[model samples]
Target: MDFETVIGLEVHAQMLTDTKIFCSCSTKFGGTPNSHTCPVCLGMPGVLPVLNKKVVEYAMKMALATNCEINKSCEFARKNYFYPDLPKGYQISQYAYPIAEHGYVLLDVNGEQKKIGITRIHMEEDAGKLIHDEHNPVSYVDLNRTGVPLIEIVSEPDMRSPEEAADYLKRLHEILVYLEICDGNMEEGSFRCDANVSIRPRGQKEFGTRTELKNMNSFRNVQRALEYEIKRQQYLVENGGTVVQETRLWDDAQGATNSMRSKEEAHDYRYFPDPDLVPILVDDAWVEKIKADLPELPLAKRERFVNEYQIPAYDAGVLTADKTLALYYEEVVKLCGKPKVASNWLMGDVMRFLNEDKRSIRECPIKTESLAEMIKLIDEGAISGKMAKEVVEDMYKTGKSPQDIIKEKGLVQITDEGELIKTITSIIEANQAQAAEYRSGKEKVFGFFVGQVMKATKGKANPQLVNELLKKMLAG
Candidate 1:
């Protein structure tokens, strides 16, 4: 029988606070191992854990961004577990009452919109890292990441395909980064995902025994892991073997999943409210303040880009994927008053440079005003579209204006009608046979004449004037 895949992603976004969630240690990514650890995070006796106000505020912003209902009062629980990295031998998390719940994020998959349900968005503390010595075969623990603030966004098992899961993860990542609450760096382990995937008969309502997948650090690997797991489970069922409920690790190099351990049930953690900390109370006034302070979300900004700027939906999606790039597009449009032109350059050249260099839009070499000036030059016919690419590259490399670049390199477009006709006439004389074919009603040879004229002018001749001059010279 044919089967379908079900997936739910549990994402942890490390809050962009200056310090740890329950302690004052630095929340920076790369620090001396165990240097950020303190008595509170080290689980020392007689030390009290103090809550960070910024963590709550950032969590509220994320919860609100995802359309979650905030619980005014919530408490933290002790998730009892033993691990070498978990210094406290238990994790501080939310259980019976979390900060928010019953929310959803909308994803556009293959031109169709789907709302992925968010089961909850809760605050939690991160565990430390365990580094193993490759040569010595000894393991050492690093507690620098201990007590780092994290907001876990759990999704309902509403995804049917790996593509949908990837789309959902991307949308969530965008939202978090756009809110300025999370850096959304997957490689740094700031933003991570644990996928729960299972396959069952296509028409069945009940889900099959699900396996939790971990260690998928990148988005590409997440989708790959899920696809592999689906096929593995399907193969098992077809061979009359039952699928096991367990946690698996995705080996990206091998492109497969290996059983990590038996998946523990919720009760296995044996959660209980922590006595050292008090419950967090978020009043309506506080919630309203955060809501008012929220930035324009991705969906709203995308719609505005299409409706107000008159760009295509695809352009809007690409531009609004990152908040800074979207802002950059608007600044260029304001200066050039050409939305499509701005969208094309931003989505094309701007994105290409940023991706190639592994840089963010904020760190872009070409300033927004510089890009606007280059685009405006194209509009004014000061340079051809082909010339604009060079101008933009110069702007990126030397941080120079388009005017300066054009003046220095003599890259200005040859828009003079007189000069274009002189070149166009010489080209027709060279391609006399094709010109004769054109004069005798072979319209296909028209393109050959145009190509020769552009070649003669070295692509600097104004294309419109070139075409006009070519047709005028060839027809005669």
Candidate 2:
């Protein structure tokens, strides 16, 4: 029987606020284990929590960007759980009333558009990290992240494949970063996802038993985890084993999912509205203020790149994947006025270097202005495309301008008409048979003469000049 995979993601994005959601503690990623803790965040007795206004503003920005309808009034609730990482016996989160709801994210899968429904986006505080000692049987709790502000985005079960889940995740991540609300750093746990995966018969209207997958730290891992989970459930159902509802941890190294515990239903949390914190009333003025300051998001920028810049949709998507990189491409285009050239070099060599070193485009050594200058050099016939690549490498290494590298390395293109004609004549005389065949019916042999001339000039010869001069010389 044919089966279809169902996936829904719950993404937790750490807001870029300077302080925790309900406390005045620093929200920095790395610090001493308990240095950033306080009475408010540590859940000490006789301490009352105060909500951070900035956190709400950031959440509103994301909601508006994702087309979510903001709830003018919402309340916080306590989620009951027992874990060492959660210093507070119960976590403060949204249950009865969330911040936003009824949104959708659009993705393009193989030239076809797909819409993934967003159930809700709510505000919550992150739990602390539990550091387990490898050498001994002891574990430590780091309370620095105890009260970090996070907005959890819950997606409806609209994705039918692992790729669709990954695509939706990336689209969400890109928008969050573009809005500058979250850093979207998966390694540091700023942006993370929990996937709910199940498999059911293709024609069935009902859903199958689902398992929640956690500890997917990267986009690639999210796809891998979902793929593995889907296959495992399908195997069990095919072998006459009943699918169990539970939570699982993705073992990346083992490439499998291990049972963590039985999944908890809604009542397990014993949720209730918090008495200390009142309902938040997000007025129209506040939402409009955030909307006015919003930057152009990825989807809008991608459409502009294709329609205005005349580049391919794929190139536009890649260039706009990261906000910083997209800005860099635009600056280069502004400098050179050649969007296609800038897009090619940025997507080709610039991305290659960034990916190779595991670096962000913001950390790129080559300046956008310098890249524009290099493209200008290519347009002016000062260097060939191949030679410009070498200059770009040197520029990336020393952060030098292309002109300085070319002058220092003596890699100027041989554009002199007289010099190129003399070299082409010499090549024609050396290869008389091929040249004669070119004068006859063997038109394909013309490329041989051009290659010979370029080889003689060591790839510095102006290719257009070489072709024109070679054709004129061989005509006789």
Candidate 3:
């Protein structure tokens, strides 16, 4: 039976707030296991949890950015659970009423736009981490991450393939990072995903039994886990075996899913409105203010780059993938007034250098002004493209201006027509055999003469002038 895969992702992004959601404890990652804990986060008696205003504001920013509708009044509920990591028997989260709902993000799937529905975006407090002793039968709890601010963006089961799911996750991750609300670090547990995947016979109306997958730390892992889970369910159903509804952990090393436990529904959590915390009331003025402060999102920026700058859609997508990189490209274009040229250099050599060193655009050694100056040099014929490649590398290594690098290396282009003609005339005389073959209509030998000219000029000859002068001198 042909089966179709269904996927939905629940992403929990840690808000970049200084303190935990319900307490003043530090929300910094990697402190002494429990050093960041306080009376409130530790859930000590007689402590009343206070809601952090920054958390609410950050949630609002994401809600608005994702086109979610913010509720005027929302309340927090206690999710009853017990684990070594969860210090409080109940986690404070939004259940019955959430901060936002009914949002959608568009994905470009195979040259078509597909909209994925967002069920809800709710604010929740993160639980602590449990580290088990390697050689002992003991486990330790780190309450540092406990009570950290989290906004869970729940997507509807609208994705039909693993690629779509990955694309959707990337879009959300990009938005969170662009909004500056989350660092979007997957490995650090700042940005995480839990996938609910299932498979059913194609054209079936009702959905199949879905299994929740956890422990996928990266986007590739998420897509891989989903792909594996879909096949697992399909094989089970095809072989007349029942598909189980369970929470599974992705064994990344073994590349399979292991059953963790039974999946739990909302009622299993025993949610109730917290009596101590008051309800949140968002005003229109606050929503408008957040909307006003929202940055141009990735899709809009990409489209503008294509239309305004007249670059390719692929180029625009690569340039606008990151906010900082997009800003850097814009600055380069502004300085050089060569949008496509700037895009090529940035997308080509500049990005290659950064990726090779595993550095972000913020850590780039070549300043935007320096890159623009190099592109201008290329446009002004002050240097050939081949020479500019070496100069750009030097600029990256030494953090110097392109002009200085050009002067230091004495790599100026030999664009003088007279000088290039003289060199080309001598090249034709020296390589008379190859030049004779060229005159005899062995046109491929023309490249040999061009190579000789470049070698004769030590790669300083203007490539365009070389080609023009070589064609004329060889014909003679």
Residue pairs in collision within model 1: none
State the RMSD for candidate 3. Answer: 2.2
Model 2 lDDT per residue over 33-121, tens place: 89999998888888999999999989888888888999999999999988898987999999989999999999998899888999999
Q: Any idea what lDDT model 2 has?
A: 0.92
lDDT of each: 0.91, 0.92, 0.92
Query: Model 3, poorest ten-residue lDDT window?
Result: 260-269
- Give candidate 2 regions above 4 Å deviation: 133-138, 262-267, 422-452
Compose the digit string of candidate 1's lDDT tens values, residues 1-476.
Answer: 89999999999999999999999999988887788888998988889999999899999998999999999899999999898889888999999999999999998877888899999999999999999899997899999999999999999999989999999999999999999999999999989999999999999999999999999999999999999999999999999999998889999999999997654554488899999889999999999999999999999999998999898999999999989888888888898888998888988887898889888889888888888888888888879998998888888888887888999998888989988887777777777888888889999998887787778777787887777777777779
In candidate 2, list every pair of residues with a backbone clash. none
Q: What is the number of backbone collisions in each predicted candidate, taken in the order shown?
A: 0, 0, 0
| lDDT of predicted model 3 | 0.92
Residue-level error in angstroms, candidate 1, position 349: 2.8
Better of 1 and 2 by TM-score: 2
Show the lowest summed lDDT stretch of 10 residues, model 2. 260-269
**Which candidate wins on TM-score?**
3
lDDT by residue (349-410, candidate 3, tens digit) is 98999999999999999999999999999998999888889998999899999999888899
